[model samples]
Target: MIQLHDKQFVPFISAKEINFAIEKMVSQIEDDFFDETPIFIGVLNGSFMVVSDFLKLYKKPCEVSFIKLASYEGTESTESVKQLIGLNQDLTGRTVIVLEDIIDTGNTLEELKKLFKSQNVKHFKIATLFFKPDAFKKDLKIDYVGIRIPNKFIVGFGLDYDGLGRNLPEVYQLKEE
Candidate 1:
């Protein structure tokens, strides 16, 4: 168990499970883009650990970049997204793959889609390590997902609670009061 802020959370997904999921996704990506060079765009902070592990197994010729966006305060979404760190790559003719920690309302991904549109990106896909299908309201297909978890607040392996619990090897969900 772990405590973040004033709540207690128990182990939800173990590290081994995380690695397995990543490996599973890597195989799919290799098969899909084995002959192309795709740029892996990681949404910062939350995707740090996920992107790290993913690249270790991504042997195909690819590049990586990061952009930071925020729409949450602690465990709740403020329902507004803002770019903290803007993207600085010339993605004019590249296949881009967005690596995200999780997707809830999809506001962030929508905003990024707009950004990519403005850039004239050749093609792009979204990937999230964790997905909350029940909570996702936007009509966008998250191209790849590590796990489809219930609409529960989770923290660990790059997800955080007010800047804590991100370093935990296993993901944990809040304990019921």
Candidate 2:
């Protein structure tokens, strides 16, 4: 078990498992986007690790950018996403993929849809390393999903609790009291 601040967590997903999941997701993306280059827009903060690893595994030619959004406070989603960093690229008629570390409440995805709808992009796909179907409240279709987990608060592997545990190589779930 590990403690970050006042919360304790137990190991949930190992590094090897995480990498395997990512590879599968990447393979699926490669199949769909082999003919043309796709621009990957990574959600900042939590998606840093996911983006780095994803790029390393993906050999095809592609471009990457980042957009920072905030919707979580501690372990809970505020259900309101605020875009802190905006995209400056011309995404008109381009294939854009939004890389996210996790999709729980789908608040951030909602914000992304609103941001890209007016950009005239050919199409946009959502790729997330982790997903919580039970917690997802939005009706959006996630194109690529690495893993589908239960509705439990977790940290590590780019997910954090109070801005901690992002550096951990594996994932951990909140320990029950």
Candidate 3:
């Protein structure tokens, strides 16, 4: 177990499980994208690890980029997404996939989809390592999902708490104080 913040004790998701999930997700994406060379837009900070591992398993040709968005304060979702960093790639008419570490409220992904549409992206899909279906609030669709987790405060595998613990090798859930 690992300690998050001051009083939380969280267990790690373990490397073995992470690897297996990535393999499955990659297969799904390969089948969906087919011949199109999709551009993967990774949501920064939280998605760094997932994107890195996912890219390695992708058999098709593709490009990778990043955009940063913030919505969490401590362990709770803010329900508002703030675009801390903007996309630099020209997505016009390109097939794009937004890779995210976790999907909770769906606010961030929804906002990104709208932005991509306005930029005239021909196609877009969402790929997330973890999803909290119970907490989801928007109508957005997740094309590829690695795991469905309970609505709990989680960190690690690139997810962080107050900008720390992102480099941990596996996912972890925060322990109640």
lDDT (10s digit) by residue, model 1, range 40-112: 9999889999999999999889999999999988888888898999988788889999999889878888888
Cα misplacement distance, residue 76 of candidate 2 (Å): 0.8
- For 1-177, candidate 2 gives per-residue lDDT tens digits of 999999999999999999999999889999999987999999988999999999999989999999999899998888889889999999999999999999999989988989999999987999999999999998999999999999999999888999899999999999999
Stretches of candidate 1 off by over 4 Å are none
- Residue 22 of model 1 has an lDDT of 91
Question: What count of clashes does model 2 give?
Answer: 0
Instruction: Name the weakest run of 10 consecutive residues (lDDT summed) in model 1.
Output: 114-123
Error of 2 at 22 (Å): 0.6
Higher-lDDT candidate of 1 and 2: 2
The better candidate by lDDT, 1 or 3, is 1
Which candidate would rank higher by TM-score, 1 or 3? 1
lDDT, model 1, position 30: 85
Model 3 TM-score (2 dp): 0.94
Candidate 3 displacement at residue 102 in angstroms: 0.4
Off by over 4 Å in 2: none
> Among these predicted structures, which one has the highest TM-score?
2
- Top lDDT hit: 2
TM-score of 1: 0.97
Q: Cα lDDT of model 1 overall?
A: 0.89
